[model samples]
Target: MQREPYRLVHSVSSKFREMNHKIGLFGGIFQYAWNNRKVVKNEDDETIFVLVVKRYTTKHEPWNYIRPYEILRKCEK
Candidate 1:
C-alpha cells in the first residue's frame, strides 16, 4: 500500500492564505467545465497551473467553491 501523491491547495483571500502545489492526478482533470476557472496538471501532462475560484467571500461558507487562487504559470502553448 503505497499511493499518496496528489496535492493542490490554494485559498488566497479573506485572510485565508494557503498555498500548496504538488499536483499529480493524471492529466489533472484536463477540463470538464467548472465555471469560475480551472486547469491543473503536473504529472508530465503539462498545462502548468491555474485554478482561480474565489468570487467574493466572507471567511468560509457561501456555497464554498473549493477556494482556489494560485493563478499564473501557463506559458507553453
Candidate 2:
C-alpha cells in the first residue's frame, strides 16, 4: 500500500515571525510524521509538502535567542 503524507497546521506570534517561516512549516509536518512514523523500511523515504498560510501582523523585527529548544516550544504553540 502507498503511504500518505501528514498534514499539520501551526500558528505563530508576531514577535517570532520574520525569518525562516518555511522552517516552521517543515517542523509542523515533521511533528506529524514523528507522531506516525512507520517501523517497516521502504526503498524510498521521502517527505511531501502541503499548503501553508501566514497571517499578517503589525509587529515586525523578530528577536533571536541562544536556546533553540525554548524558541521551538514558543513556535509549537
For model 1, residues 3-64, the per-residue Cα lDDT tens digits are 75444343233233222221112113323223324444533322222221122223223323
Give the TM-scores of the predictions, in the order they appear. Answer: 0.15, 0.29
lDDT of 1: 0.28
Candidate that would win on lDDT: 2
RMSD, one per candidate, in order: 14.9, 18.6
For model 2, the stretches where C-alpha displacement exceeds 4 angstroms are 1-18, 41-77
Point to the candidate with the largest TM-score.
Answer: 2
Cα misplacement distance, residue 76 of candidate 2 (Å): 12
Error of 1 at 56 (Å): 12
The pairs that clash in candidate 2 are: none
Model 2, span 1-77: residue lDDT tens: 47754433333454346335634544564466656665656422342111111111113233233255236746745
Clashing pairs in 1: none
